[model samples]
Target: MMTDLHVVPARRGRAVRLAKGQAIQIINTHGQQVVDTWCFNADDMSEFMSMEHLHATLQGIFPATGDGLTTNRRRPILILEEDTSPGRHDTVIAACDVHRYAALGCTQYHDNCTDNLRAALGHLDLRTADCPAPLNLWMNIPVSPDGKITWGEPLSKPGDHVTLRAALDCIVVMSTCPQDMIPINGAACTPTEVHYRLIA
Candidate 1:
């Protein structure tokens, strides 16, 4: 059964705590918005879902249903239980930050996934020293055979979702990407809200 639904507002983030065996269903309500996701051990913040470790563990960049998302210590922290979309989550990009925006030619501060993660954790009286690369849900970055990657719009339709089961007691964070500078969210470059729920 699922509990009350929660919303990750556009250009912002939210964090939820899950017990072992529980799962989170993240819905792409508007379909095109990219949700930057991260997971950390509740008892030990340093041990977080690491894209590098996951790459080595899965022996691939794209994680599919039933694949274990590994932590920095190379242990499973969550399982990709179900994916209703095209199963094209990204593992290669770093979360967007102020520096990234500046490099993009922004003259002033801008909302970014990195700060969103920090702010989300701060809401729970939690803090971490580093920001690990995020699992870019619904963001499409196509790779060429010659080591080139091209940003593309999301392929998921409205209401598509993915369910991730907690392998350990952990905190999962989601950020509705605010990248208006690119078409990663969609061809229109507009980010929208997403909904999620805790499943028992």
Candidate 2:
């Protein structure tokens, strides 16, 4: 099978279709950046990958290798094939949006994941609510004993990546999280790269 590669610019997003037995690799080309990611059943846009369902089924808050990320209907969508980061990917936190930035007081045209996903999936009509919160790759959102979640710089270094195998034909969407207001990207955002290919 031929390999497919796509570059996702900083503060932007990209989308791709994956057949079963295929996998998508997300590269954190520049360190300290986060990629907001989610996917859907290629045959049914309404059936989306759900972080909640994954937690309920896996009995864990964050994903682990060998775990299958599931859809809202509890069907497997993708599997966590490999993780080469420091193991700090986040399942908590919603994708960044204008409203979130507005609440943070920088309301003027800030690049965000919500818009990126919508733009990337141009063929589909999606509302913010329609898109669930994503698997935050390279994002460090740690929960303190007090139960407060804090955003910190990623544990991932440059060139680190994670791969997800499609359990079904799927539509994968991702965004280079454009959050400069916080330290999630170490105060700067950068471009990301994605590679896709068949596994066997």
Candidate 3:
């Protein structure tokens, strides 16, 4: 493993560049935590991982092991290599932003996934606008037949993890979601470990 970083509990995050053939693993050191993740083409920021593209390719609602994620243009981006969790991840939910907190009456500055992602990507010269919908690893959001979405705690257990291989050179940005107000992250936020290495 070339890099191993521990994200502090709630509202903390990190980002890194991975060459083609490299892989990364997001570990749920403690269960009930959701990893808000983003992937972007290293060569062109405009070409990023697209959830809509994945859904179409998979012909299913969620991604499975061995399924490949693609960019907006349908170019290959990442391949799901390993999944220790139930694979009940999410792609439809937008990262929490300032406006969301404001609506919750916390007008003051608060830690959020949207801002955390930007902070992690800051060194790369990327902005919040460059971020797209993330793959909410270990998150639990179920949609009913009536089209109502209900959020709940993660279905993952402690030590569960998911790994992804870079189909193309890209950057991985993520946040350890600090959303204590919702049950998307077990109603409490905690630290998680992100591990990466060149698979060769």
Candidate 4:
């Protein structure tokens, strides 16, 4: 089935269920913003995501086309179908939580990403009781050759996006990043959108 394309704004939330072989595009409408994303196996919620495995398989710091995003059990969850030509996304940065909020002097924004995640899960009839770690797309955090990581400027531009193809029936939860306390998503907390399309 082909799903109509939809656009959502930054700091907004969207939930989607992607069947095996389907593709989803998270669009950075205004650019320089991060999108926190998470996924779970529709058949088994316990089979969560494994960033370590994904990084291992991808064999690099950032995700690129043809890289396989793996789950906790070392199973392929999604495939990177496309990425911006000059932009590089960070997979090491975990999703925002209350602790990070307090450290960033934006404790008030604590619920922003969390709220989006919960809302997305609720849309799929799922619960936060099993919320899993998320992936930060379009976030540019540079790591030194010595392993020191620094939050860098935004690497994406207007209309930049990352596309992923589901390898299994999965529930995807995402947050149009509202991070204004850091340079990762730029100083402005702009909005983003998610576009879905079925692949034949």
Top model by lDDT, which number? 1
The per-candidate count of clashes, in order, stands at 0, 0, 0, 3
Looking at model 3, residue 75 earns an lDDT score of 70
- lDDT string for model 3 (1-200, tens) is 54645454456878778899998877787778888888988888888888888778777668889988878999779898999998899977888888888887886888888888888888778665755888888888898999799987889998888888998999988788877677787765544444333444
On TM-score, the stronger of 2 and 3 is 2
Query: Candidate 3 has what TM-score?
Result: 0.90
Candidate 3: C-alpha RMSD to true structure equals: 2.2
Error of 2 at 100 (Å): 0.2
Candidates arranged by lDDT, highest first: 1, 2, 3, 4
Stretches > 4 Å off in candidate 3: 1-9, 189-200
Every model's TM-score? 0.99, 0.90, 0.90, 0.87
Question: What CA RMSD would you report for each candidate?
Answer: 0.6, 2.3, 2.2, 2.3
lDDT of 3: 0.79
Clashing residue pairs, backbone N/CA/C < 3 A, model 1:
none
**Model 1, range 115-159, lDDT digits (tens) per residue?**
999999999999999999999999898999998999999999999
Q: Predict model 4's lDDT versus the native.
A: 0.74
Show model 2 residue runs off by greater than 4 Å.
1-4, 123-129, 187-200
lDDT of 1 at 169: 98
Which candidate tops TM-score? Answer: 1
The stretch of ten residues in a row with the least summed lDDT in candidate 4 is: 191-200
Query: Where is model 4 more than 4 Å wrong at Cα?
Result: 107-109, 128-131, 189-200
